[model samples]
Target: MKKIAVILSGSGVFDGAEIHESVLALHAVEKAGATWHCFAPNVEQLHVVNHLTGEATEESRNVLVEAARIARGIIEDVAKLNVDDFDALLVPGGFGAAKNLTDFAINGAECSINADVAAACRAFKDAKKPAGYLCIAPVIIPMVYPESVKGTIGNDDGTAAGFNGLGGQHVDCPVDDIVFDEENNVLSTPAYMLANSISGAASGIEKLVTKLVALA
Candidate 1:
């Protein structure tokens, strides 16, 4: 069986991994006959957000601990992820991706990715393995691959610009579609970036997972 490594940011959409996207991607992986292993950086979140009110709160939380909430406790520190053990990589989007995986949410084009996250992702690229990024998580693609790697964030002009600024070739993709950088062996989709509903997001996510597993 193909083993896919999933890097989640946190447990919520506002400050962590988008739960829906994460769950949907995992389900799709399993349905594709692929097994998934979840990982997260062992660091503090940039800031906590009250998902209820969409406001920042004064609290501290470990990225891995919060991410475990979504993983149902079956997760590990990203630093322990060995690219050789996995066939492909998948990173589901949520504010936690930008906030914890990389500082794209705050620094945009100038963001710096967490060391372990960068190492794990770049390991896949260096090994020529296929990988997929969903929603805002594509922001990490440019930071991982070479210049002009094609990616998408569901046609958000500002985010697209940031992606381009970071040396990526941003493509306008819809909620039910994906942008594949065949040359780089990378894939991206606009999950919640354009989806107004779960089924809408699943359309592209399912396609992405199917293609991702096939590529693996």
Candidate 2:
């Protein structure tokens, strides 16, 4: 079985935007019959504020852990178990993860870079293991493997400008279609617009998953 590490932002608050892609990715991986491990940044508290009422809420308290701790746990789990044990790294898109880090960093972007995560990603690339990213998750790819080719699918006309800045080739298409490079690496989606098109996104995800499993 090919093992994959699924990375997620530790924000317990389930914003409609964040949960959709993550859940979809999870579903796709499972449907493909691949093994996966879940990873999340740790926070002492996760707050959820009501948009209308402005009331602040927090998740249940537990032993407080910092982002570094959680990231370390990911590394430890990967290492102790062996990197070759896993076939690839999977990152899910969410606001909290994107906000705090340029590419999975913590502490308002000023924190020490998590070289471990970067190293793991590099290892995957060097090994030719298939990597998967959805939505904003692709933002982490350029940071980790700048030389890798990438393609974006869906109507990101306005957002495509920003992606071009990252040196990614943006293809104008519906998010439902799968976009890929010649090597068949999975790429970005029109996640910003395709939130309601669950069926479309699922089809795209299925295509990506099929390609990735073939690589493995």
Candidate 3:
């Protein structure tokens, strides 16, 4: 069985909606007959602030603390394992992963810009092991390959502007629709949306895992 790593942001909500993308992706991976591992950063607990108001409130703090605890636990478990044990790395999208100061977001950035994560990703690529990402998780690609020959993919508005600071073309299909280049160097998909449904998310995951296994 191919071993895979799935990364999730600890935050449960993003843009007023709960992030069920990662959970659904997990289910799909299992169905694909791959061994799955979960990773979340255990960054320092932070107080949640309203993106619109920028106000600090008790409710926000509590919520963030809880998220951090969960993210930390996941990361701790993954970090203990040898990366060589896994055939590929999978990153599932959620608000927590996209938001800064959290595990998913922080680690995603690291994997994108940091030399270590980049090296690891490159190694995985060289091995022909399939790496999977859904929803906003594709953001890591641009971060890692800012000026590569590969094109971007996601929920962008055609002009490549999507999410808070990310840019890519808006895809009409489910997040499981994997877009890639001839070299298989670039993989893109849409997993999360502003007005998303749980059923859609679940369906997307099933497609994503199936596509990934086929690609592998």
Best by lDDT: 1
Can you rank all candidates by TM-score, best first?
1, 2, 3
lDDT of 3 by residue, 64-165 (tens): 334334334444333343567787677666554455322334443233332333454555566667676666656555554334424333445632443224
Q: Provide TM-scores for the models.
A: 0.99, 0.69, 0.67
Model 3 bad stretches (over 4 Å): 15-19, 45-81, 101-123, 149-153, 162-176
> All candidates' lDDT scores?
0.97, 0.53, 0.52
Give lDDT: candidate 1, residue 194. 94
lDDT tens per residue, model 2, 72-179: 443332223345778876765554344422332233222232344456666776777777766655555555555435655356464454455555566665666655
Task: Report residue 189 deviation for candidate 3 (angstroms).
Answer: 2.0
- Candidate 2 or 3, higher lDDT? 2
Task: Choose 1 or 2, whichever is better by lDDT.
Answer: 1
Per-residue lDDT of 1-216 in model 1, one digit per residue for the tens? 999999999889999999999999999999999999999999999999998899999999999999999999999999999999999999999999999999999999999999999999999999999999999999999999999999999999999999999999999998999999999999999999999999999999999999999999
**Could you tell me the TM-score of candidate 2?**
0.69
Top-TM-score structure, candidate number: 1
Clashing pairs for model 3 are 42-72, 135-191, 156-170, 160-168, 175-190
